[model samples]
Target chain A: MSETPDTLVEPALARTPLDALHRELGARLVPFAGYDMPVQYPTGILKEHLHTRSQAGLFDVSHMGQLRLCGRAADAAAAAAALETLVPGDLLGLAPGRMRYTLLLNDGGGILDDLMVTNAGDHLFVVVNAACKHADLAHLQERLGDRVAIEVLADRALLALQGPAAAAVLARFVPAAAAMPFMSYAEARLRGIPVLLTRSGYTGEDGYEISVADDRAETVARLLLAEPEVAPIGLGARDSLRLEAGLCLYGHDIDRTTTPVEAGLSWTLGRRRRSEGGFPGFATIRDHLDHGPTRRRVGLRPDGRAPAREGTGIVDGGGRPLGHVTSGGFGPTVGGPIAMGYVASAGATPDTPVTLVVRGKPLPARVVTLPFVRQNYYRG
Target chain B: MSLIKFTKDHEWIRVEGEVGTVGITNHAQHALGDIVFVELPEIGREVVQGGEAAVVESVKAASEVYAPVDGEVIAVNQALIEEPARVNTDPQGDGWFFRLTIADPAQLEALMDETAYQSHLEDLA
Candidate 1:
């Protein structure tokens, strides 16, 4: 279920009814997925990010992948186990209405994709990146086959209500939503519209991912946004928010050539999986976990206001190249520039000095501890 | 008498008495698409014509605003800082970014008038 963005118009690149709302709000619209989405509003990315941290932000994550995995009790459990074999996360213990973040791994232990898995009744509800959803499903089917049924829930939309005020704003629509614990999923009626509300989000802020039927998604979104605290945030704000929160972007931070361990996500691997060593590419993962990966992901703070964008070469003292920036931008919340990249594990310290070569200039940079801003996620 | 001035970078200046108002023409803001941030010079900062005066960053890119006439920044529209969308809202009215006290009144004659500036925008478009 993919659409070719090459054409002037592709119907599969679906449009949310709120498209008009964005234009009316003077959003800078760009083609993302198959639909036109606002990259940012007039307030700019930096301001939007700071606003989210100080208050709340509404994100139209409708383009995200939403799907359902169904099978008998024993079959579903087997499917979950098979999935767990690929990534370094525990899925078998995921109770219904609980969600866990994990990655899809290739046989070589490289990350194919990172996604969220939620236990919804007898089936597992999965949300992934729109661009990688097709490949992710193929990978799942190739491994699990008919033993577990997979259905691409094309009729659903995902909206991430993020930031400190997210709970307060959402509470007005779904009072029960405020009480749901973090990383847990709950089925609730949002203004009488059936929705899968999960206290999980990419932004480090306390937020919820509300999935609703395509027809009713707009209704629920409009209702939630009616609160004064909610602002129609765009991709630019979302990127900065995640960056400030230190969350990884799949293609940029983690890739098919990078294993989870090398990406500094070994913690996502359950303790049992580490001992059993039964998952695919377990040998390579265990080796990295035991001896440590040669390179690791770390946060970088650039000197001054100039942003060190992705692909910029990162270097050590004397201008010796070390790594490359994956994502870099002016962190609205941090009030400075920040970046993330893979650096030699030896030089990946909290205060290690590095330089980023931007436009033929060696800009001073330093490694800083992650989550540049403290995450305000509400546990409950 | 009021004198109008222009900067090669597309800023316009309209000097009335000792005070001058600086703004980016509708053409400039339209091309930028959704002004998100406007970094204005502090009041009382001295600047010369053709020198860097401020910065305007949009969602897609950033651009430097230039001084159209020699002046001392007397005031800045703080509203734009809190609501940058005003630039897109009214590039010539509520979008006017700052006012300056003319340091060299002679520099005003070098700018483009309404007719000339309109033609300049047409050529670029």
Candidate 2:
């Protein structure tokens, strides 16, 4: 058994083929997503984040959970239906090579996790964070047992190549990669190794996420890094990139305590599913969907350069507490400060003035639309 | 060129006459990761040694940059107000955080010389 304490504690360390490369890059390794991954590099988070937005950045994301679902046609469709019972998306309409983002709901309609499900020709490919993988797998098995074949792709590694020049940079090696449109995926070969490539990323840029066998991951990453456009980006840039993109971080922006509707993710719900109501916690979700929620997620723009980080309390003019910041940072791309938080539904409107209590000082903040920076996804 | 001294907290002070240019070390920037925002002190603000002089935040954590010596802020790096990552890119050069008029030139005794600070970082490694 190759199981060690570090491996057992963080599945990412045990799985990522580029783990050694991260160390070589002088990354400050930390336990994240059940794997020891680099949080930052010697260049620091701000530079890394900006560099990725301006150029191409390579990210080792092998710790994310990858799974394959297989069964007869009807059985697979039934399995999709079963999975849909827990999330809000229309899984039946998901075409082959296409992907959709959705949330896993609890019995109370609260979000358990947000995940991606892709229709791969003969099977469904699902990816989730390492921290939520075990629970998600158990939940899927519990709900759709015996009807579908659930297999964890433990030997595969995932890499996110993101930035403005991602397509141009990746095309040099993987020519077929340039053809994949945003949210679509395809199978290709790199260095004689067959791989799965998808046009998706967490950073607000055009990018591709490649899934390759563990043994060949290092070679592919090195090949990509050899290009002047590609640099190794750590978790720090990854966090800021996603934040600027206005995407939710699993633990911070989403948790068991928040519901899909409250998080502004009701669009993931399929029209047929909304009326059919077959999924878990459908009634609760429908109730919030129809009547609206008491609290909603809002984006905040601090007036000054100071950052209002997570856990910062937000208040009204009279100092009455309103909400707490879930995720906040100085967006390198937007060239200022931005934050996201949960506030009373009444206080959650664009241009609403609020105050962030940071270090015993109330900082001026204005409610703004999410994605402090505009996303530049390559639809074509 | 003047002798550069570093603090255990990672701020650096380079004395030239009665003024000292204060900024975080490259090692400090590397440790803090990506810098998203920097809170600079007002020009002419008087600060005591070891007191909070500024706040630097990265995507992961927020840290206070303490005054290396009792001084009066004479100038601040206004460039960081719009582009904070400049500190991460050129922390020692273009990223000089502030220029302070040293109140007591003798306070430099408490800091580490370049050799000593390099050894300290080596020990950490």
List TM-score per model, in order: 0.79, 0.86
Cα lDDT tens digits for candidate 2, A80-134? 7657767878988988888889888888887888888888877888898878999
Which candidate number has the best DockQ? 2
The deviation in Å at residue B55 for candidate 1 is 10
**Per-residue lDDT of A1-380 in model 1, one digit per residue for the tens?**
01112213445555765677778888867777667888877776656777777777878888777878876574346557656766778888788778888888877889888999887867888898877988888987887766678888887878888888988888887898889999998888877788889997877889888888878877877787688887778887888788888899989999998998888788778888888866777888988998999999999999766667789899999787789999887676676668899998988989998999975678898999898988888865
Q: Give stretches of model 2 more than 4 Å off.
A: A1-15, A41-44, A72-75, A169-176, B1-6, B13-23, B34-36, B41-51, B67-114
For residue B12, model 1's alpha carbon misses the true position, in angstroms, by: 8.1
Task: List chain A TM-scores, every candidate, in order.
Answer: 0.94, 0.94
In order, candidate lDDTs are: 0.79, 0.85
Per-prediction DockQ comes to 0.10, 0.29
Candidate 2 accuracy as TM-score: 0.86
iRMS (Å) per candidate: 11.3, 10.9
